[model samples]
Target: MGLFGNFVAGGLAGLAVDLCLFPLDTIKTRLQSEQGFFKAGGFSGIYKGIGSVLSGSIPSAAIFFIVYEGFKAYYSIYPPGSTSEAAVQAIASALGAIAACIVRVPVEVVKQRSQVSLDSTKSSLDVFRETVAKEGYHGLYRGFRITVIRDSLFSLLEFPIWEQMKTFYAVYYGLEKTAPLAGACLGGVAGAISGFLTTPIDVAKTQMMLADSDALATKMGLLQSLVRIGGQGGLPGLFRGAVPRVCWISIGGFIFLGVYDSALTYMSTVAV
Candidate 1:
């Protein structure tokens, strides 16, 4: 599919998955919070920071798929001699994730803080304004570095695995067309694996994003955050929200990638 098709498909997919699975995401965030789940407002209002995600997910996902598809196209034209297809896909996915982080980090900061807020009346804009007032505009990007790292690692695993699975399915079934259900199932598996492995980094990212301005975690780097978490709660602490995260991302991946593939296929036929 073309770049514009990628953008539209990605935007639609992102919106669909995020809106549908926001509650799971909220649970994952609260589970990873330093104050623990119940203290972080628990299940009271899972949609608290949805506004932030709603505003950013489309553009961020659109940008990612555009970059991803664009890179793959470029590589197709000028093939990298020694690099394997999987390696190329991983590289492209990581780059796309890094690009997406420009929009995603700020959204995450606002969304996560809002998720843990005790006051249900606090709007997303209130969180935005409060963050800026207390920590300047930079506060919106509190976890930018770690977010980029975490997402890059995630995409590195997810995209390549998903693509490989689809390849295997095609070879096995002798099918030329993409099947949405198969894509969704494979994507879910890929996302689950990626999410499970990346839970520790995710936990650190969450802490960094939600840390108070004067908190030690705020001053700490990603490595430092990981170390602190490990020291405080051992291995389990590092993987705080593994269950919710895996569940959220796996289901989200099913929806997100399946929708993207379906939309892109429809757009391709229409363009023809």
Candidate 2:
């Protein structure tokens, strides 16, 4: 598909995924939050920042797939079934993640802040404007470095594993390509792995983003944040929300990639 198609499909898929599973994401954030799980709001609290999440997810995902698919097309010179396919996809995914960071970082900051707000009544736009006013434009981009690291690693792990799994299914099942079910299943598996591996980084990124901008007190770097987290509860503290994170990401991957592949397939047929 062309870049524009990727943008639209990716946006729709991402929007659907995030909107459906935002409560889980909010739970994951709270689980990883410094507020501690009990104080982070319970079941109903999971939906606190959902509006912010949706507002950001659509555009963020669209931009991500635009870059990802564009790079994938540009790097598609390797022959089909070639050994380098996974490697090529990994490179493209990483590159796309880097570009995606530009939009994602701010959205994350707002979403996270809104989720953790004590008032619990603030809207996404309220949190966004407050952040901008309080911390200037840079406030929205807090934790940019760690965000890049977490997202890039997620893409690096997720796309390669997903592509390889699809290849395996195609070869073993003698299918022309992965069926939608196959893609969704494998995508869930890939997302689970990626989410687990990146949870520690995610912990640090969330802590940094949720840090109080009022006093540069939490302006710690990645290493510092990790150390601080370790101090809180040792290594276990770093992976505070592994269960919810994995569950949400696995489901999100299934929906996001399922819809994405389906959209691309539809687009291809239409073009033909």
Candidate 3:
């Protein structure tokens, strides 16, 4: 597929994956936000707001992928088929991640708010209603700036680190055919590291966007939340949701890379 096509394909794939497992994402967020891990049955706990989360991820993924791919292809230094420099690859990944993050901030602002029932207002439908009622359309986009910064960091670490990790695995395993497996492992590693690093920021962002209640209002605004978490939980508070996010995204990455690589290979074969 061409760059745009690849993006559309990848975005659609991400949407599907996210939709199927949105409940995991919702649970993970709530578990992180309030330690609501036991609120649901065993494995099913990860799926708290599957319905609401879907409303956000499906369209968001497609738009993000298109933006990321467009920026990458346009700004890349080396021509297609050249020996890509590691530094260049890193820069490209960062750029692409930034682009994707910028596009995605709004969706994330919506998703997290919809996921947790910290307040009586949860569910995408209700969250949308409440946001529109209170904050208007722009209210739904609250905390988008922080969301971009936070997820941009994820993009920076995830893509470049993933590239390096996969390279290491492919060389170490000496099985070109198994590179997808290697890539999946690398994706997991990158997601884990990035998720932990970004957890506090994620928490703060979520807190900011959630529907305003006296409880939440008293709880913390953006700056105050940062201070409270820092004072009490320290760095750990920020990463409260890391474990589940890492696990959730890891499996998603595995499935994503598996299909992505397989698709690429088939495309190459047909082109040849």
Best-fitting candidate, scored by lDDT: 1
Each model's lDDT comes to 0.92, 0.85, 0.62
Q: List the residue pairs that clash in candidate 2.
A: none
User: 174-231, model 3: which lDDT tens digit per residue?
Assistant: 7554465666666777777777777777777765665364445234555777787677
Compared with the true structure, the alpha-carbon lDDT of candidate 2 equals 0.85
Clash count in backbone of candidate 2: 0
Candidate that beats the other on lDDT, 1 or 3, i.e. the better one: 1
TM-score of 3: 0.76
User: Residue 239 of model 1: what lDDT?
Assistant: 93
lDDT score of residue 167 within candidate 2: 85
Instruction: Estimate TM-scores for all models.
Output: 0.97, 0.95, 0.76
In model 3, the runs with Cα more than 4 Å from the true position are: 34-48, 70-84, 101-103, 118-123, 172-178, 211-224, 268-272
Q: How far is candidate 2 from the true structure (C-alpha RMSD, Å)?
A: 1.6
Ranking the candidates on TM-score from highest down gives 1, 2, 3
